[model samples]
Target chain A: MSLDYLTALIAAVLFAAAPLILAALGETISERAGVINLSLDGTVLFAAMVAFAAARATDNPWLGLAAGGLAGAGIAAVLGVFGLLLGASELAVGFVLTLFCRELAYFMGHGQARQPGPDLGALNLPFLSDLPLFGPAIFRQSPVVLLSLVAVGLVWFFLMRTRAGLVVRAVGEAPAAAVARGLAVTRTQFLCCLAGGALGGLAGGLYSLSVKPGWGHPQGCEGAGWIALAIVIFGGWKPVRVALGALFFAAIQVAGIALQDVLPGLSGTLFQIAPFPVMILTLLVVNLRRSAAFREAARRVPLLGRLVPRTAGGAPGAIVGALDKGF
Target chain B: MTGRTSSLARAGFSLALALCVTLAIVAAAGAPPLTTLAVMLDGGLGSGQAVLRTLSALVPLLLCGAALCVTFAANLWNIGVEGQITLGAVCCVWFLRDLGLAGLVPPFLAVPGALAASMVGGAAWALLSGVLRTHGRVHEIFSGLGLNFVAMGVSLWLILGPWKRPGMASMSGTEPLPAALWLPALGGRPMSLWGLILAVAAFVLVAWVLNRTFFGLTLSAVRQNAMAAERLGLRPKRRMLAAMALGGALAGLAGGVLVAGLYHRLIPSISGNYGYTAIMAVLLASGSLRFLPLACLFFAVLTVGSIQLPLALSLDSSLAGVVQGVLVLTLFAARRLWPAGNTGSTGGTRNRGSAA
Candidate 1:
């Protein structure tokens, strides 16, 4: 393949990765603080519908993005109350909440099926505009991509350098330790979960206002939330790494689509099944106790590296500090 | 939730509030106002045929709900009842497809064989999830969920592939089953004797296992306090799998009966998300096996009311899903106020306690 092929590949990867990037980043924050919200799937559908409706009403794509994020956060806030304060199990509450939110979106979005949302126009960077096929695909998308990168930086800084982020991590790693050290465990968890919710909402906005705009069906959002969840596990609870995992997942997804073009003989349904099997396989092989090579590779694979660190002494500050530098 | 009194009044209040909220939604959908709800009540409970239809729907829901109760009691969250139902339907269809054998075996013999196949299929399907949870360290909730999707995929492939009736989709199913394999109608009634017989037998068996047997006691112990149960030599893994397997088998049997007694051939939409709906029923009843029959009646009424909207007001049929969602949310909210009575042994009080 030529450099042009490389350009096309990167562009496709970015296009595919954007939603996963936003969703997984949100989930990373949520899970990092020891809260697992399975509601991302439902949150995505509702937010997509909300953003679509908002964009149609105002004809302002930016408002749609805001609406989607708010919609996503609205569901997340419900989860926060039950999980943080009511002391409900995160798994059950999150799963059930997701089901309710998805149904709510389906019920409400019934009428808006015909009217497509306003699409956010493309943004082309001045210097990067001339980089062949990759330039337009990579640089000339909506501002969501740029914002995702910025959010990654901000989240990385917040989680590692900031005192509040430290408290969030403390709560996740050991709630008892955070409580002993004067951290309000519930409050930190609430903050992380809600932030994750907002980002999840933003991911929905990116879909409705950018990719597949105005596409309204019963389940048009279709499995993106589960993909986001998979990305988190793939990234192992780190923002930048989650982004990389998003890219990897995006690549597999894009490949499934791209393969249909080259090999029409192979059933696309079978190809579509490939990623899930790959995911199941990857997960099966993960978390080994005594494999040194697996441990080393896992620690160096950027997002996956977050799972197993390579520090010899295992010092807390030093390890987190090393993670901080890596990001 | 434990050590707190005052749950009865709270649960009662929440249920009423939820029902009222549902009434309001129906009104907004341009159905007749709150007063017209009486018409719905009359329609659901008034006419003999309407009542019979509601009972027909109730029969399967009752069986499924009872089956669900067992799993929920053990905290096992078996959401794949729909698939088990589908698989059971397939097994029944399998036996019926053999035209020569169908003539040889009498209806009584064939019916039991079909029921047995269904129960076994359902049990094995559920047992796979149980095995994964017990040995593979995977969470049962997600694994069960994944199996639900897998089951759907298999169902679609079967219907669209091998089981695809020549005019099925055009007519929407296989050629209707021959009368020989059909579930026998009750004495001088339109309802199936099998429906009543199977439902009653199941209720008796579940109640006996849950309330009478040592295994029943052990299962509750496993649910209430897994570690303490283990300390007392009750293997939680085995208890949970048994509970789920039992739940799965009954759900599957319900699926078979639904096919033989009602639809007779497998269609893709046979599930109607009933397995998931059973979750609402199980939760609403607080997994009390005794209350499941009543919960099924309430759900049957709820289903009739929701179904009336499409013909009566052009409302989408998915209104039932939203209503069930509302029911589940209310149930949890009710627990917040009332403190789940049976759940006293659960929660932070027993950090070692678990649901399946």
Candidate 2:
């Protein structure tokens, strides 16, 4: 491919990766706070429909985005009320919410299906838009992509450098310890759920208002939520790495479509399912890396030691311990 | 007896709440709520044929629900049941075509042979997920879901590539099996009594094994505390694997019925979301066998009835899913307020505990 073609492909991949980056990071926030938002798949679809309907009715894309964010937060609030407050399992509540929200979206958004609606326009930054390949790929794109980029930086700084981030981590690692330190564990968890859900809603809004740019039955982004959830584990709950995982998945998607053109005989359905097995294999590798045998082998070899980090990151302690204590 | 009455009353109240919420949703969507409900009821059970359709739908639901009961008894999620069903149908179709068509198998043995192949196919698929959870350290939920997608891909490939129809390949699925290969139905009707018999038998077998057999008690013990069960000299992993195998076999049988008894061909969506719906039905029953059949019947009616919604009300057929999901959510919420005074509720609580 020519350099121009390569640049455009790269730009397209980044653009497609924007929503997934937002959703994965949103989930990253929730999981880091010791809550697994399993309703993510349904949340994105519902938010997309709500965003499309609101934007179409009001003729304002930003309002649609806000509505979508509210829709997501509202679902998260239900999860919290049932999970933390009422003593139900968060996983079960989230699972039910997944199916509930999905059907609700389809039932309520039927009329809005395939109807044209307002969408966010591209942002062509002045000097940056005129620069090299970076300009066209990063500067001259949808504002949602910029939001996702900013979100990565903001989430990283918030989780790593801020005092509130420390409290969140402390609560995630040990709710009892955080309680002893006078931090309200439930409140922190509830707030984090809301914040994470809002981000997830924004990601959904970005789809309806920008990326896919319409509401429909399939909506073209049906399983994106599950992909985002998987990306969180692949990123090991780190914001930057999560964003990278999203970008990588988007590339695979684009490559799948591109491969169809080269291999004309193969059915397109084969390519559509390429990411799932890859996802399973990636998860397998990640788990294997943390096994004792792998660490011992790394210790014996100097080169392997550099490749395998001394400390293997794990899930938040609160999640495992909470499971241990039973619902 | 009073506790049973109160539990029944609570169920009635939750059902009423679910109905109100569904009707309110319909009103909000600008449709006449009562009319829609009546139309759905009429569509589902207005005629003898419609009831047959509902009963046919019930066959798969009952099988899958029984399948889940076994896995849930052993405290395994088995989310990959959907994939197991798909693999079963694929194997059934393959068996019918390769052996029956080629005359390698007698006409009398075609149906039974195909069903057996499907059970093996399903059991193997479920075992893959079980092995991943046991040895690879990957959670069953993720592995099961991943395998579901892969299974879907496999079915699609078979439909469009190797097993495509004679003239052209399409999403409609592969060539229909010969008449002799099809499962027998009463008086040439679409509904097969054999499928229903198989489903009921599976449920009865599960109930017996879970309630009376020594293996059943061991499964319950393993579920209560895998660590404690291990210390007691019982092999928890082996029991879990056994439960998954049994569950997969029943689910695979459901798929075989779908192909041989109902659709008469291998389709991309042969499983028809029965596996997921069965999961919901199992949850609604709260791990009790007595309520399992009732839950399956209710869901079956809604599914079979909702097919007519678009024609009658111009509404999407997903209304069925909306109502089913709402009812389950209401029950989940209700359990918080009205904890049943029976082991049924205790079983539900214990299942959630093991989910952690």
Candidate 3:
């Protein structure tokens, strides 16, 4: 590929990764707080529909985004109310909400389907857009892309550097200890779920208002949430790593599109679903590193020991423990 | 209140709430609620043909619901059941076309061969997720979801590329199988008595195994406390895998029935969201075999009935899903409001497991 084309493709990948970055980071916050907000896939679709409809009605993309964020937060609130306060299973509630919100979005947004709406376009940074490569790919993009980049740094800083982040981590680690520390455990988790949900919703809004653009049934962002969820595991739940994971996934997606032309004989649907199996394989590899036999083999061989990175991170202790307890 | 009475109260309350909310939604959407109901009734069960359609739809719902009961009993979320059904259908088509065709297999044996292939396909698919859950340290939900997409991709590839209909590549699905390979249907109707018998028999057999068999008790033991079950010499992981395989086989049967009895071809949406819809029904049933069949029938009605909403009321057919979701959510809310007492409760009383 030519340099200009390569630069453009790089920029496009960055743009495509924007929504996933937001959603994954959002999920990272929630999971870090020991809540699995599995309603993400439905939340994205619902948010996309709401964002598109609101933007069309008000003719303001920002309002559309805010509306989408609210839509996401609302779903999270339902999950929290059922899963946390009422002591229902998070997986059940989240799974039900995912399917429910999807059909509800389609049902309610039927009228708004295929309607034209205002889209958020790229804001060209005068000097940056003219830069050799990095400028166009990084700076000369929509605000949502910039927001996603900012989100990585911001989430990392919030989780690692802040006192509140410490409290969140502490609560996630041990709910009883958090209670002893006078940290409102449920409240903290609820707030984190809401925040994560808002981010997921914004990601959806970005899809409709910027990334994919326009509203329709079978919205292009249907399976994006599940992929984001997988990316979280692939990234080991670190903000920066998760952002990188999103970018990597986006690159795969872009490559799929590019490969469609090169291998015209293959079906397009095959290209579309290529990343799902890749995600599963990555999850298997990531998890396999922690398995007993893998660790044993790694220990027996000096070279293998060096090759296998020390298992620094797995699921949060409380999430794993609680889920295992089936409570 | 006794657990049984409280359960009945919750069910009734949830039903009332679901009805109120659905009617309100229909009225708000500017369609007369009563008219919508009547229209859906007419569409789903107004005549012999419509009843046949509903019954055909019921076969998958019952089978998928039965599949879910097994997995849910073991506390495994087999969300990949949707993909299992798709794989099953693909396998059925593959068997019928490749082996059963060109006089390789007799017509009488072809249908049975396709069914067996579908069962194996589904069981293998579920086992993959089960293995991932037990050994790979991957959560079944994520693995299941990922496999679901991959299964869709595989089916799509088969339909559009290798299995495309003669002279045309289309999203409409693959070529229809020969008549001899099809499940024997009621005279001139699409509904098959054999499919109905298989679905109902499978459900009843599952219910018996779950309620009476030692294997079912062990599964319950594992679900209740896997650590304790393990200490008691029960192999929790193996039981979980067994549950998943059994569930996958039944789900695969549903797929086979879809191809042989209903559609006679592998379509893009062959599963028709039945797996997820079955999940909702199973949730409402809340581990009780008694309510599960009713839940499946209720959902089957809503699904088949909602088909004519666009034509009759200019409303989206997805209203069926909205209603089902509301009903389940209301049940959850009701259970929260009125927690069942310690006595006279079955598996439904547990707040420890994943679902209602």
Give native contacts recovered, as a fraction, per prediction: 0.09, 0.46, 0.48
In order, candidate lDDTs are: 0.70, 0.85, 0.86
Report the C-alpha lDDT of model 3 over A123-154, residue by residue, as the tens digit. Answer: 78888778897688877878887888888999
Alpha-carbon runs more than 4 Å astray in model 2: A296-307, A321-327, B345-356
Report the alpha-carbon TM-score of model 3 versus the true structure.
0.96
Cα deviation at A277, candidate 1, in Å, is 5.4
Could you give the CAPRI-style class of model 1? incorrect
Docking class of 2: acceptable
- Model 1 alpha-carbon drift over 4 Å, by segment: A1-10, A132-134, A142-150, A215-217, A259-282, A287-327, B1-5, B20-46, B98-107, B167-171, B185-193, B231-233, B338-356
> Over 4 Å off in model 3, which ranges?
A321-327, B27-31, B341-356
For B36-132, candidate 3 gives per-residue lDDT tens digits of 9888888888888888888888999999999999988898888899999998998999988898876688888999989999999999999999998
Of the candidates numbered 1 and 3, which has the greater TM-score value? 3
Chain A of candidate 1 gets a TM-score of 0.85
Q: Top model by lDDT, which number?
A: 3
Comparing 1 with 3 on lDDT, the higher-scoring candidate is 3
Model 1 deviation from the true structure expressed as Cα RMSD, one decimal place: 6.1
